[model samples]
Target: MTEPMTADQARAVVYDAYTTGLPQAAAAKLLTGRATPAWVAHEYAALRRRGVSSMAGQQTLFDTEAAE
Candidate 1:
């Protein structure tokens, strides 16, 4: 069975896609098969859990439900 890709993996996928000239939306779709919401959240959460600076001031909310 294939291992699930983590947010870092997703980020790498995004980076590769962007460098390859893929549009942000299309690249995210093709690589992540999901929206940017959980990706950013998981990243930040993981970092904070590890006592690291995860996005911090750079955080952006892609999860509408989270704002509700």
Candidate 2:
């Protein structure tokens, strides 16, 4: 049986998936992609820990990482 996810738990998972270099689109393709907007935002925030700033925007970070 599947367990229900809390808002906080969903956010943490989203953050982890994003930081691992998975595109938001791809992340969304997964069942968990339908997570709350707040979770997605939190995911972006977590990316900041990887030398990426949320204020810089997601596309910017993806392109920058690609170039590196």
Candidate 3:
């Protein structure tokens, strides 16, 4: 079996997915064995709370919606 992912690694994955416009729930599903949807949702909330500008210097769909 593969090793479990660290919290940081999971967060990074979630961040990358989120920046690509994937919803937190969908990203969580993608991490099936690595992280839970609840955990991913929490991390997503934290990112929103922190006002993360962007991972690739471009606003995400979610960001645009929030701005409108």
User: Against the true structure, whose TM-score is highest?
Assistant: 3
- Which run of 10 residues does model 3 get worst, by summed lDDT? 53-62
lDDT comparing candidate 1 with the true structure: 0.52
Candidate 1 lDDT score at position 28: 50
Candidate 2 on 16-68: residue-level lDDT in tens? 55656666655555535457455565566566667763334356656866797
State each model's CA lDDT, in order.
Answer: 0.52, 0.59, 0.78
Candidate 2 least-lDDT 10 residues: 52-61
- Candidate 1 collision pairs: none
- Report how far residue 21 has shifted in candidate 2, in Å: 1.0
lDDT of 3 by residue, 1-63 (tens): 788888888888888886776777789888997887888888888887888744543454446
Clashes of each: 0, 0, 0
Cα error, candidate 2, residue 56 (Å): 16
- Residue lDDT tens for model 1, 1-68: 77777767776655454444444456556655444744544543454567643332233334455678
Whichever of 2 and 3 has more TM-score, that candidate is: 3
